[model samples]
Target: MHPTIPGFTYRRVPVADDVTLNVAVGGSGSPVMLLHGFPQTHLMWRHVAVELAARHTVICPDLRGYGASDKPAEDAEADGLTYAKRTMAADAVALARALGHDRFALAGHDRGALVAIRAALDHPEVITHLASLDVLPTLDTWDVMHGTGAAVGFHLYLMAQPPGLPERMIGASADAFFGHFLDIWTRDPQAIPADIRAAYLAASRASVPSVVADYRASAGIDVVHDQADRDAGNRLRMPVTVLQQDWGTALGFDAAERWRAWAPDLRHTTVSCGHFMAEEAPEDVVKAVLDLLTR
Candidate 1:
């Protein structure tokens, strides 16, 4: 068993479709759910979870295709299970309800952020506050990366390729594939310990198809949902905070300005840390969430 925080204990609970999720529970007041990003697990939030558990009921879970959860194969030809963010978002909502939190604060990183946004939009009654780290909504992300921005996000396009291709290519050198992001995305490499890095690579290697399917869903079905929301004039109604890298200069679009369109009560800022802000700059992330919740 992992060492428990002063107020939190680890728990494993089943969610939608008989999929059991490994979760860490801590703190007391209002419930707060944390969803981790790609190449990482709930363990990524060890530091932040404990800190938040001091004041709130912190609930951290390994997202659907990531650590310890079921990884159903994708049938990209049809709108398969992996193609829908709604399925993943439903898992989160069910997980929260299983934990007795009808409504709670929610935060997610990278791929997990996509799920968090869907949860807030589809089940606003269940998400009291929302925070997304290092990602824009699906359609806006695709819209911004037209020319040079697309080059920087080559994986986004590469992963969108036909099923067997991306899975085989990425699976061939999983360590290098996952490690490349870990090295380039983080301003501080030492934030993730060597053992943890190895574990991430191993888990990623074992789940190549699932990982590829996740990105593929972004390009296909997820974009459809995002566009539908745009056409419907939908926006997040709850308080929202977004922390991202300074992709403005690099990607040629102002991140804050773009997010303001979707979240009117948004507190968007670009941090100096790399994509793994929660692990690399835990204090800043914690402070940002606290400030947003209080606001």
Candidate 2:
């Protein structure tokens, strides 16, 4: 129920046996799927989707364990991991196919950006274009966060811990923990409306375990998947656009250079806004996605 994206309808799409994604779909044209990140749901795309809807069919979904989507508990015995980005990326591909979109432009922010990268790599034939906002590749990100840099991404370390403790600590005060990012990530607190912020907090609180599992997989199993891809020299062949803050300078790497390694056909630049770039600076996001489509 994103009031801003008028006429959009919500549906529960079954992407897997145990996973059903809550999706908001509208518009009618070349399709474009937008995915949200941590602490927020598909609602983050309200503004951008509305504008895109004028020329492209816009689909926004609460990625499996976020928003109003089904929250499946972690089953440790399911091989080494359950919430890997590969699993989440599968959901994105299935969701689009289920909606009759065999090929579409794809864009995502934060956690969703990671999923989009995985999707573009895994299902490039279906995802014609790719856009990632405010993130580095998961492998590069982990490399940067080791040692003293770990303090900057304390949440990454915390969630990477074995399931029980991180879940308990976060669940104890989910609102405070999730809300802390909402306050700090945005240069302007007014960028996200009060109601939207409340919705994000509520969703995070309700999906604590699923969300934590998502992070846990990133810390453990996700690295293995990324390494295998890098070792095999599997790079993203599709045209890609990445809009992000220049955190690389702080982390001692050329952000664009790192991205160029994976995205061979790439457009990488730093946007002026904060982590919630899509919402904090919707026009910039829309323009970037449009540029990706145009390319």
Against the true structure, whose TM-score is highest?
Answer: 2
- Residue 207: error of model 2 in Å? 0.6
Residue-pair clashes per candidate: 1, 0
lDDT of model 1, residue 42: 82
TM-scores, each model vs. reference: 0.94, 0.97
**Which whole-number lDDT from 0 to 100 does residue 201 have in model 1?**
81
* Candidate lDDT (C-alpha), each: 0.84, 0.87
RMSD of candidate 1 to true structure, Å: 1.9
Question: Considering summed lDDT, which 10 consecutive residues are worst modelled in model 2?
Answer: 245-254
lDDT per residue as tens, model 1, 1-295: 3333345566778886646777778778898899989878887888898888778989888776777677777754568556377778888899888988889989999888998999888898888899999998888899898876588788999998877888888888888988998888888889988777877787788778878888888988898888888899889999999999766477778888888988989998778888898988899899999988897
Tens digit per residue, CA lDDT, model 2, 1-295? 5343577988889999998999999999999999999889998998899989988999999988898889888888864356888999889989999999889888989899988998888887888999999888899998766666567788998998887999999999999999999998888788888899989998899999999889988877788889999999999988999998746456676778889999889998888878898888899888888888988
Q: Highest lDDT: which candidate?
A: 2
Question: Which ranges in model 2 have alpha carbons more than 4 Å from their true place?
Answer: 1-4
